[model samples]
Target: MAIIKVLKRENPYVQIDKTGIDDPNLSWEATGLLTYLVGRPNNWKINIAHLSSVKKNKETSTRKALLELRKYNYCHLFEIRKGGKYIEKFYLVFEVPTQYDEISSNMDVELKEGEKIFYVKVKKERNSNNLPEVENQLMVENIENKGVLPNVEKPKMVKPKVENQALINKELLNNNRMNKEKNHEYDFEEKDDDLRKIEKLFKEFGIDFSIKHKIKIKELLQKNSVDFLISHFKKQYEILKKKENVKSIAAVMSKHLFQGTCEVDSSFLLKKEQENQLQLQKEEKEMKQLNNALQVFLTLPMEKQEAIESEILKKRKEINPQIKKISTFLFHKMIVSDIEILLAKEKLI
Candidate 1:
């Protein structure tokens, strides 16, 4: 992290209105120092000597100003060491006044840069001869004074609309009765003979007669047996009409037989199974090739083996080097002596 210093355009004393004090001897240096300290970025610590020169006569005044500024909530005072020396460091700590009473009269006044159209009230008093003492005393008095009472407003009440429970219940009952009558009418209506035949076909195939199953069966029927089944049912209906006890033409037609067809070609399924078996065989062959490569790698010189081991160790930083060596041996299915034999043959050592 880097320390960032922001320079304010106006003198700290002028910004805080300390220059306008009646006493010519009044030191506004403390006010300026406080302003600067408070304005620093949070989490930064500074030494007291960094503020001004250390002198016996000025030391008491400087210390007093720092303390006074803290009392007014302008800065946070603490001790710190800078450049191997112990010193006091002040941190600027400004908090928005929770109450109007918390505002200080002697402090510099300015609208916050981003604030708009805000007003506040302050008590006015005659300027006294001991301006610094008067200012200090006023600050003390303000801190001691109890805060003002907060203003509170009562919320307004609203009337709710009244509903007739009896009327609502009667309307709900009428809706239910009308729905029941509609359902009864639908149940008594005659079903199409061709649709009945499709249903019978699903039953013959031992398929679940659910809504989804029926939809699937209908789609299959449309693609396959729709025209044949309709013609067969019409013929059955004509034969039944010749008999005297025919209760319904639709019912008689509904007795006709149905048969379904498959979408997938049988030859296509056999071809797909054959391709899957070839893929499995190819995978097995690749495994055998990897095993052969490992065997060849193991039959190398000791020096060559060490070089490869070092490379593997370096690459496997997060893993234990010993565990990695054991894993490599097991993976390749070769011993250390095998490595030396291969290395000698290749003249690598």
Candidate 2:
């Protein structure tokens, strides 16, 4: 018979079952092992070193104690496959386990004395100490512009305040200047490009844009677009090249070009100008009609205008079924009416 034992302490204690203490079938060694195993968590696994309680305890004595414990059925000792071979495992079942493989992988398997378990590990290899670290992508910055001993003191960025419209404009101007400087590092190339365009335009117009003319044209380009100045140059070149000079070119520019009186013998330009004026007049007349229509439509009730729009759109479908929306239908019809008036005035189809 074994005697039940309760080892008590100030802050901790262990519960030992009286069955292991009083059972006559268990030897003293088995009883001691059973008492130790029963006091542990039911899911914990016992090892040889755990059975021996001391660092220098003999492995043979621990093995015999385990064998004595197994004979009395206090726990289970079994073999299982781990890393491809059979290995002995102990399950502190206290009672006989129905499932032979009851020892789970998560069971608290005790380690041998002096065994070190490192949860975190350092890889053993060449330069193993210098492992790569992850960092934020946007946080990386150039240190060269931050000044001397930059690593000692981080560069502070003070946001430029915009308290008023003038301050806001000043900040925007500074930002634009910086951006222009950085992005356009080739202003000379841009100037050369403009000169190339001017040369090409002169080639197209069958004239030499002379060095003096080039200087004057570059000055003009500061305010006018390349196409606008070049077109005007073409017009003046045609009139002055007929007059026997590029310096005489200034005559047309100073007198007629600025005053909108620069007329050339070009039937094509005249025709295009007339068409543009006629188109402008047509648009103005359409706008006037739309305004008048809007006034009359506004006088009617909302329902009446909606009904008239429906009827107008349905009629417009006879000309082109593609005009689907009421707004587009009315706008197209008004434009067509104005175009008809303009055609009648010009006596064209």
Candidate 3:
């Protein structure tokens, strides 16, 4: 809530008869003059010729009233020289009594003017703490000279260049070419070592280097390193030998072993499988039961169903008014009698 304070300035004189000459042609120049004079300091003066243009007759009447007001100590008249010519000036010097205080005080003041009472309202300036100080001479001088105070220069921001898809693709292609070249170099070095190892093995074993044998060795050398190929072949030979040994061992074990000697019950596995099948059957039966219940509920007469719903709604209203509101909105088109029957069938009444 905003806090406002009332300020009042009392009128020094009261009107007796208060009958004004009424003319639609009457101008607001007099009013403007009064407002301008009232806003100035006591000793401030303004030239009469400077008043905005008005009808001659109205201007004469306004000037006459102003003079009368001046005689009554409401204003002061003076003469000033401007451009070597003497001009008549008006100065309103009357003191206007006003009360000043914090806006938080909720006191209201009424000002009397003739037969009318006017209310004076005052409001605290918003964000007064954030307002610039009027007494900052250096800032004021800078603003007067440059129209704005000097401030620290801000660094200009640089925008990042966006790479197009074509440029990105070109960079990726160059990287892949370099990687392929490096891979080719590694492959040549590895193949040279494997070829030397093959030649040495052939010489040591006194194996015939026929064209078919050379082609087979070259094909194997292309796929793997020399050490890796030797280890893989050894592993394959061991696996074959182990498989034969395992078959012999199994044959002996089966001949000596009997069913009575084993403690594991094979029927337990069959029973577990049967239990799982029964669980699936039970789930299917429960689904069928639910489907039957839903069909039975759906087959009931519309009137009976509506009656049950109404009865359910009435019970729900007793339990929670919010639920009743929601249910009423959902089933607003249903008959009251049918809803009552629905509630009775469901034993919810």
Candidate number of the best lDDT: 2
Clashing pairs in 1: 37-92, 38-92, 299-342, 300-339, 300-343, 301-343
Cα-based lDDT for every prediction: 0.44, 0.50, 0.42
Candidate 1, residue 43: CA error in Å? Answer: 34
Descending-TM-score candidate ranking: 1, 2, 3
Q: What CA root-mean-square deviation does each model show from the true structure?
A: 30.1, 38.8, 36.3
Better of 1 and 2 by TM-score: 1
Q: Which ten residues in a row have the lowest lDDT in candidate 2?
A: 1-10
Q: What shift in Å separates residue 257 of candidate 2 from its native position after superposition?
A: 99
lDDT of 1 at 339: 41
| TM-score of each model, paired residue for residue | 0.24, 0.23, 0.17
The digit string of per-residue lDDT tens for model 1 on 186-257 reads 433422354567667545544335665445545545456656754544455456556567666443333333
Stretches of candidate 2 exceeding 4 Å from the true structure: 1-11, 42-46, 53-57, 82-84, 95-349
Worst 10 residues of 3 by lDDT: 1-10
lDDT of 1: 0.44
How high a TM-score does candidate 2 get?
0.23
